[model samples]
Target: MTPTGDELLAMLSALANPLRLRIVAQLAGGRDYVSHLAREIGISRPLLHMHLQRLEAAGLIVGSLELSDDGKAMKYYEVVDFDLHLTASALAEAVRTLPPTDQEKP
Candidate 1:
């Protein structure tokens, strides 16, 4: 899907961080729970949650709360199926849909 200018910007901004990039790379392998993902990525759960929230906001990753066998709650995250084909034409189209900002107005 062609993202709007704001969406494109959000996705780019979300991916611009090294930590977020690592989170995406780790999730690319498979879906994982919060603690496991944190351990694999070598970051604290809270920090990972911040990154995950950004990814989720950008539509790059999705999370779901599930119950473990023992009935404990676990939050799992997985990379969403998304294909972003960025090109000049795509950017132009996206820009056209952008809302006017104060700085953009005369």
Candidate 2:
């Protein structure tokens, strides 16, 4: 399937941040619960949640809520298989097709 301009923008935006990149790298190793992920990445849970939301929205990650043995719902995050092989020409073409962002508006 062809990717939408918005999808490409969102994925790029999500990966642009250092924290989010680390989150992606950590999730790459294995599926992880939020608490453990935050601790391992040296970030707070809320902050981690924000980054996870962006990644999830961008289709770079997937999250599922499951009931644990204690009957508590735990959210687990895993990396999605999105091998983006972007070349300079492809990126330029994509950018050429992008509608003007807010900053470009008068």
TM-score of each: 0.94, 0.84
Local distance difference test scores for all models: 0.95, 0.90
Candidate 1, residue 100: CA error in Å? 1.5
Candidate 2 residue-wise lDDT at 58:
97
Please write out the lDDT profile of model 1 over residues 33-76, one tens digit for every residue.
99999999899999999999999999999999999999999999
| Model 2 misplaced regions, further than 4 Å | 100-106
Segments in model 1 whose C-alpha atoms lie over 4 Å from true places? none
Candidate 1: clashing pairs of residues = none
Task: Pull out the clashing pairs in model 2.
Answer: none
- List, in order, the clash count of every candidate structure: 0, 0
Residue 77's C-alpha lDDT in candidate 1?
95
